[model samples]
Target chain A: MHDYTMPFGPQHPSLKEPINLALELDGNYITGVKMRFGYVHRGVEKIFEGKDVQKVLYVAERVCGICSYAHSSACTRAMEGILGLEAPTRVKLLRTIVAELERLHSHILWAGFGLHEIGFQSMFMLFWRERERVLDILEAITGGRVHHNYNKLGSVRYDLPKGCEELMRKNIAELEENLPGLIKEFEKNSVVLARFKKVGKISRKDAITYGLVGPMARGSGVKSDIRKIDPYEAYDDIRFNEILEEGGDAYARAKVRLTELGESISIIKQCMSLLPPKPAEKWKWPPIKTGEGFGRVEAPRGEDFHYYEIEDNIVTRGKIRTPTLANIMILEKMLIGAEIGDTPVIVASFDPCIGCMERTMVIDKGKKNWFTESEFRRKFCD
Target chain B: MKRSPWISHYNASSCNGCDLEILACLTPRYDVERLGIVLRESPRHADILLVSGVVNMQNKDRLKRVYGQMAKDKYVIAIGACGISGGPFHEGWNMAGPVDKVIPVDMYVPGCPPRPESIINAIAKLLEGLE
Candidate 1:
């Protein structure tokens, strides 16, 4: 080891979010990785407290941008558990469809990001271009493309909007037509394979030890898909297979996600077939009673868990364990003993959401807002 | 289109909504590069600074340092409601304030996350005002 250390970012090209990592290098090879969080911390759990029960639903969705629907799903399910409300089958089906669509867009976004890191700009652009179809489908249903505020306590805010079902079917068919070719191109690409295969290989044992979830663990042939293991929101009613890869490397994880995209498409189809014309349950929310509830939903990254305590129609306490928190544990191990050239590829493989994980940070008290924009300009901008 | 405004993006504490939209504008469908606008990597090379999310204690100073790194002609655009006024997370215990609190903002593009079209419109407006 040369024992030289270099800082990767709090702001850098390869990283979409702000995260600083100190890397110990031996020439072009990285020997150690020390990750520092807290850049995107907003104290969401603290923010959830004392908020109205129905209102906290939106806050939970805001927890992770990629997994917004999953967080809202988890949050709603938990509050439903506390309220003892069993939403009708139709509601479950709608949620499942939206959730699967979210996975579609999210996986595509990840693919674009992964391709971008490997410098395959055309493929990156292609992936994102395809992603817009899924986003358009989502916008047709929820009225908002990215931040869909669709979920409510007892029922969704609205029934599947008129004509949205047709829109969904058309988009799904188009994506079904396009995905195989894209995945085939991705797998066959020499640059992608060379950069990804056997890079950051993890054993099933290490994945288990590190408690890796989502595609990270699934890549190692671990069948830990919460949708299959502990089905929620019509997941049990749907027919789909859990995609797994035995390779236990970056390519394997990416393969698992790409393969799962097909499976998610199937699940959404099943949900559409199962969705009834009538509203499943009314949108009536009862008075919030004092109780504790927990929910688990398989976010795109992994299993996202939410716990909430209600008192007199307001949240008294709340905690969220996002998938990124679990998946990021294996990142430091993956980076060790690897060439520094592969740093971005290896890090992007984890799809780390520091915003979700950094929700837990040491709050700095007495840090109050100071000065307006003009005041700051007068003092600082030169 | 005088000098091709090169843009840099920073996330203070976003949920990724606006950030994703900003990147979406660069894709084939929106393809802002065709208009000669490039998304640069370094703040030093950027002419326009796109800041997303609410400012918090951990990132407040980093935001300042990043703003300082950009050249004097930098145009700062606060993206999304969070960037403008902290949005739904204004009550966050760790939130320092909006983007404008710590740095001067030349434009405020509002939405929980403004669409890719909104971002494109912001860039056009920026160019028009620049001329």
Candidate 2:
């Protein structure tokens, strides 16, 4: 029984974010694991305390660069609900198109990283090469790739650019053609299947208890999707199945995302076909006297929820709960009693967005002076 | 082709916009390693320091210390609207403003969070200027 504590990160190559995981090892087996965050805090939620509702939308979007559009959409939807205003049909459809596009790009990006984590460079490269097409489409439409500030308070800031529909159709066609081959490769690939299957198993019961959402929960046979449950934007009109897997392992999660990519393509096609004849003339930019609202959207990772309170047209209180936040809890649960070697794969499998997780800033109330990940884990878990 | 460049990243109290994009470049999409650019976590191993976010008092000293630790001939490429200017956090009581106030910057990539392509382009431009 060799008792040694191994520090995983705050700055580790395997980790994408500044998360520190303290693993108490019993000779290569992780007997106990603790996860700590907040190394990249920017006080985003605190800043939203006293700002105009419109201005707060901008700040909320900046909460996470990868899921910026999702956050903005959630925030705007909440604000719209509070103001009792519905965006024009055209605006709603456009938002859905952008969101589904974001999903396509994000899922591909995550899949590439998951492959890279398991020492699969070729798969990583291939996935990213396909991702570039999505980025090009986004850049063509929104004039920016990652953080497209396209979602305004009532409607989108920019409408579809010239030949945008044709461009989307072409990209979608390419993805549709190439995706089956990639799926076949992923299915037949021993390396991917061996590492991912049954690696990070979380039962459906535990998933619900730990509050897991999106693909992570769905992978465990939990039928929970914000779009299906809540039905915001054009999601209500679109006909697509929520991809799910009974096995709650890393491979199941990966499969869920891979299948959803096809669903995303379908959703996009529906949006394109159902796209309104013309953009809205003037969207409802109603005033907010004083009220509170909640908005939730299904992001690439999971369900992203934004809570906001408006007073005199200013955002008095705003709090964001990203999918990563929910998924991190499940990560800790899944990591305990697991081998140390599977750390990176398990962590990357959830597609944990550090940008979203670092929103929680702990003040460290002078108990230890140094708030290590191990200590936080012990405090929270115990 | 000859210069083996070492790059360090600085998070001077940012919203993690530029930071993610910087990492994106290191990934397969842009793959900065193909251009002989290596992202070193420590400033001591760096030939170029990439700064992201607005400089605030809390992290200002840490930023200066990291910059000072780097070896000479080190270039600074400011990524994102927040790094070049204060961005959305421009006017706050406990703010120190942009990266230029603390350290000299060589290039600027301007976007709320500049896309990975833009960052790759900026790094390319930086390498060209270095040559």
Q: Which candidate tops lDDT?
A: 1
Which regions of candidate 1 are displaced past 4 Å? A363-382, B1-3
Residue by residue across A1-382, what tens digits does model 2's lDDT show? 7689999875566665566789888987888887766555666776787788888887788777777889989998898889887788888888898898899988988888898898897887788778888988888888877778887777788888899888988988898888788877887899998889889999989998998989999999998899999999988888999998999999999899999999998888898888878853775567647888899999888899989888888887778888988888777677788888899999898888876876555544666555575775465324
Estimate the Cα RMSD of every predicted model relative to the unseen true structure.
5.3, 4.9
The per-residue C-alpha lDDT of model 1 at residue A138 equals 91
The whole-model lDDT of each prediction reads 0.88, 0.81
Residue A328 local lDDT, model 1: 85
Candidate 2 segments whose C-alpha is farther than 4 A from its true place = A365-382, B8-16, B23-34, B38-46, B54-73, B90-107, B124-131
Error of 2 at B46 (Å): 4.3
C-alpha lDDT of residue A119 in model 1 = 92
Residue A261's C-alpha lDDT in candidate 1?
92
Q: Which whole-number lDDT from 0 to 100 does residue A178 have in model 2?
A: 82
Model 1, residue pairs in steric clash = none
